[model samples]
Target: MQKPALDIHEIPSPGKWFLLSIQHLFAMFGSTVLVPFLTGLDPAIALITSGIGTLTFILITKGQMPSYLGSSFAFIAPIIAAKASGGPGAAMMGAFLAGLVYSIVAIIIKRLGSGWIMKLLPSVVVGPVIMVIGLGLAATAVNMAMNDADGKYSLTNFSVALVTLAITITFSIFGRGFFSIIPVLLGIIGGYAFAYTQGLVDFQKVIDAKWFAVPDFTIPFLTYTPGISWTIILLMVPVAVVTISEHIGHQIVLGNVINRDLFQKPGLHRSLLGDGVATMLASLLGGPPSVTYGENIGVLAITRAYSVYLFVGSAVMAIVFGFVGKISALISTIPTPVMGGVSILLFGIIASSGLRTMIDDKIDFGEKRNLVIASVILVLGIGGAVIHIGQSFQVEGMALSAIIGVLLNLVLPEAKKGE
Candidate 1:
């Protein structure tokens, strides 16, 4: 029972188009901005870079794909480590190297028809990895949801998060049209208004801020710091394994939503190239690394709006907002609990999508090899086991788990078709 999809070429009226574009932007905002908020990067720069990255993706894919590039949660820990060890320069360099890894993969995929990708990382591996990603971030979401004014855990913040979560769930399940599609935005508004009644919001910054101010952009290698080495690149590039798996999973989900084989047209190679180039550009500008946003996919599932034109509009709007400091500052003032509430739903959907992938493909969970691969990947990923090499090199969490899963899948022989 698939709903009819809006064609890629179909254009709604100007008013409707503007609203839909903003809805897409709203869909991506919580996740996109959170990367910068968590990693101490400039939110304005992140937005601009994401906007550019997304446009680059569309161009490279020949406007066939409808996706928005946002700052990747996968790189949060690595970036933090890189910053502490060397500097922002080291961190950006690491991300740039990760992009190079994507480029190399794209080259391989272009030549080798992507069949090996499925053989190496099937549903048994990817599904558990996706589950681990959501579970791994559970603590962060809870902490933020309970953070008080003094930055300590408090029941007041928890209450607000609960209210936000409730509203979001209600709207997503029952609300009609735009309300249903943009539940996260409505949830934030509802929670923010409630907080305002309690005098939690500070309006001083908004009042003091100018109407328009140029964005403070930083060039990573030139302005942020100076230095790049093979060690930094090696430590970071391999982490692309997790993001790549996530990318493939998302493409599969998007194909289901739109009822089209995106994997065929434009194909994985083009998408990977687009993602790699965009990520590299973002890193060069000291912005957090970008990835295709799963949040937007959730929006499409809810709204059934599959027009690529809306994505272009969203990209243009993000670029416009990036040039305005006051707007970015205003968005930054959203309460932590509000975002925490959204994250709970958002991350859950991502995990569920992975499950959907497994079920749709009818992966044989009864098979001993499949069961073992899934089991090991989930435990290692969620348990936070780190493999340290000397002082400067390490791989752990989802990245390490994904690598292990791939290797195991390679070594294990699959059962004969009818066995």
Candidate 2:
């Protein structure tokens, strides 16, 4: 069968470009800012990182594909882990290094070929790992929405939370295509509208907030170290591996959409470097680490418009918004339940992506080695097991699970001849 011709030249007219850009912006808006909001980082900083990251990605890709880079959900668990162990700063440091990990992987792919990187993190491993990243946080989302910070569940908050979550889930499952992607946004609007009706929203801050102000940027204080926990760093490093693989997938999708060989021409290495630079820059500015956003991929898929300059426009818009304190405050007023509703779906989709990866790769479940690897990874990662080397250094949870799985796969003597 002949391959379907790629739609590479469907450029939008000037009027359409504005509408499409608005669509792309709305597509990524909710989840993009939620990362920092959840982690207690500045939402404006997230905006800046996302905008700046998108611009950097365009530069690296030589303005070939139209996509927006945003804050990644993958780093959410690690940021929480780091914050629990050390503080936001320590997690930011580790995540900043995670960006470098992407650069290193890019170099490896460039030197050894993408196939080598693929073999290193096959579907059998990545699938379960991604699932763990999502499912692991299931309860946390619920707790945050319904319960207080101290873990005590509140009847009032829980009720609103459930309603918001139901609305988001319903929209995602039964809504149309574009609606599916923006369920989070819609949920937030719905929840916010309800909250406003009930007089729960405090517009005082928004009124007090200036129309334009600079984002409060801060440097990571190295002195506030969480006592140098090697375990935490080690655990986070493995997650970076999965994200690198995801990065490759994002690039391929972009290339397919734009009808260009991005990995070969501007090269995956440069794109990865762009991500690394953006991430490091974000950390320095008190923002969460950055990654290539899948949300924007949906935008490209729908619009079929490929122009790096448009993303440049988006980046400029983000920077302008970053300086607007009132805007940030308004975004903050989006109730916790609203965010929870959207997160429930977003996190689940992340898990499903991992499953899709395994199925797409045709992973052999009958193989003993594969089964052992998959089973052990899921149990260790989600079961909340911890491994401590000493008082100061401890590897537990996903980090420990990932390391152990890798080791077992590498040295288990070929699974005893298929059991």
Choose the strongest candidate by lDDT.
Answer: 1
Per-residue alpha-carbon lDDT of model 2 for 1-419, expressed as tens digits?
22322233344467765665666777778888889878888899899888888887777766655668888787787888788877766777787778778878767777877777666666777788888878887777877677744668776666666677777778778978678767777878877777576555788889888888877675655434433457557756667866776787888888876667987877888888888878878877778878787877766666555655556667878877888888898997876766776677777888788789889989878877888988998888889988776676777666777677767766765645536
Looking at candidate 2, the ten consecutive residues that score lowest on lDDT are 1-10
Best by TM-score: 2
Give the number of colliding residue pairs in candidate 1. 0
Show model 1 residue runs off by greater than 4 Å: 1-6, 10-13, 149-151, 226-235, 256-260, 295-307, 416-419
TM-score of each: 0.89, 0.90
Report model 1's TM-score to 2 decimal places: 0.89
Tell me the tens digit of each residue's lDDT in model 1 across 157-251: 78888888889899889988667766777888898787677666777776777767766556754577657765565446756876887788778
The collision pairs in model 2 are: 213-323, 235-399
Lowest lDDT 10-residue stretch of candidate 1: 229-238
lDDT of each: 0.80, 0.75
Score residue 399 of candidate 2 by CA lDDT. 70
